[model samples]
Target: MPLSEYEQRVLEQMERQLSSDDPRLANTLKHRGRRSVGRYVAAGLGAVVGLLMLVFGTAESMPVLGVIGFVVMFAAVAFAFANPHSHEGPQGVVEEDGTVRPAGPGASAKGARAPRSGKQPKAHKPGFMDRLEERWDHRREDGR
Candidate 1:
């Protein structure tokens, strides 16, 4: 079904707005929805190879090779599903917590993200081994 003239105009306006907001992301998205035939072909080929390896390993009673084949199969499936090109670009600010956010014109010059919470990270206490070491040091100091 074809979109009406009004709908078309609205869609075009939205596209223009998106491109203006973030041109880099817009370009990445404009190419495609990020899925390609080449990716599927690679994954399929990997799966086939892994299956053959697994069968051969089982026939030969090589458990290690079988395990490796399983791992390869798992890796191929993971590669197929994974999106390597996420929207996060070089200009995005990576927060301490690992979240990427777009940088605005008035973004911080220092590039250091200020903690949102007023409380700072607490100082860690020494573990049991450290306490034992401290005790040993104290005994040596007293003997000296």
Candidate 2:
């Protein structure tokens, strides 16, 4: 069912909070709205335009122009298919009990990774962020 205006506003508020708190997590969980009838209309119109171009260009022996028009029409259909509505809910949240819960509409356990209990292992390899931070830290220490 379509959401009521009040419900939509509540959702928007919650989303704004999450996005502000952790942009990376919010991006991972982002949901664009569903493709509507308007998109179908646009696809139909694009097909009609492509058909006209093919008919006219073929008559003038302009095969390349006709191909270009057909490509545009295909792109329009591809766009419609790509814009699916997200049934996905929020991302996982850390609970007060020191457990992680998946961010469904209602809270649910999605299991957690076992906490590491042994002595810290040496780094196998440093990642790009690690290298960058290391470089900056070194530069600061050198008063550069």
Candidate 3:
């Protein structure tokens, strides 16, 4: 879930304080958001392969194959989740004011910066739940 405005402010305040107090630690914490499409694809493929292995192993009465399949599936999921966000971004590090700075010295800083989002966009557009929530929020705002 996304943080509320108040919560977000508090978090940013905390970050600013941290950066001020410990530059090294703040630098360590500065990172890009995770959104790896390739990793997701690999994980999905691995899961399917694992499932086939599991089914065949069981049918063929090979406990080892079943175990391997289970391992592969587990590993695939683990691998997917373990992967972090790509480091490549126009904004390499966030500043004390929460604005992003150019990732590299070579990157141009002439244009206005794009707004950053906490969450990455998904392959599919917003689904039913998202629309329902939007409507609900609108109704609440309208005091209906």
Candidate 4:
């Protein structure tokens, strides 16, 4: 379910408090919002160059050049896949420095807590029935 107005306000307040408390963390969070297009362009160029190298190497009968081209192609693909903005899925926990850490108990390496905001956000655990209901609701919405 969506957060109520009060919950939204509380979350915003918490975010502001966190940003003020740790500027570095805030900077990292801000950086995650968008990615530069130049990186994608460079990756594309790398792939094209690698393809050309592969074709030319094959035509020239140069086995070493063909291997190098394969390596280049692999590296380009790896680089593209490694781009942070390319990730599209459920996110994990936000670490102290705003980097994403895997979700689990005590997954935080720095053991950082939220800055003092005079109020701790209550953690809500959804019951099994509630979770089932939510899934059912989602399925209905999706016309499943």
Top-TM-score candidate index: 1
What TM-score does structure 3 among the candidates reach? 0.44
User: Number of clashing pairs, model 1?
Assistant: 0
The runs of at least 3 residues in candidate 2 whose Cα sits more than 4 Å from the true structure, single-residue gaps closed, are 1-34, 84-144
lDDT of 2 by residue, 1-144 (tens): 999999999999978877765566675466344347788888888878887887777889999988987887787777666644223234566533344456643433434343456858545565445778999999999995
For model 1, what is the alpha-carbon lDDT of residue 128? Answer: 45
Full-model lDDT for every candidate: 0.73, 0.67, 0.73, 0.69
Task: Give residue 121's error in model 1 in angstroms.
Answer: 31
Clash pairs of candidate 3?
34-85
Ten-residue stretch with the least lDDT total in model 4: 81-90
Q: Give lDDT tens digits, candidate 3, residues 1-144.
A: 999999999999988877766666676567433445787899999999999999999999999999999999999999887735233445575543355656655443433344456856546655445778999999999995
Off by over 4 Å in 3: 1-11, 22-33, 83-144
The deviation in Å at residue 30 for candidate 1 is: 1.1
Off by over 4 Å in 4: 1-33, 85-124, 127-130, 133-144
> Candidate 4 — what's its lDDT?
0.69
Candidate 1 yields a Cα-based lDDT of 0.73
Question: Local error of candidate 3 at 101, Å?
Answer: 15
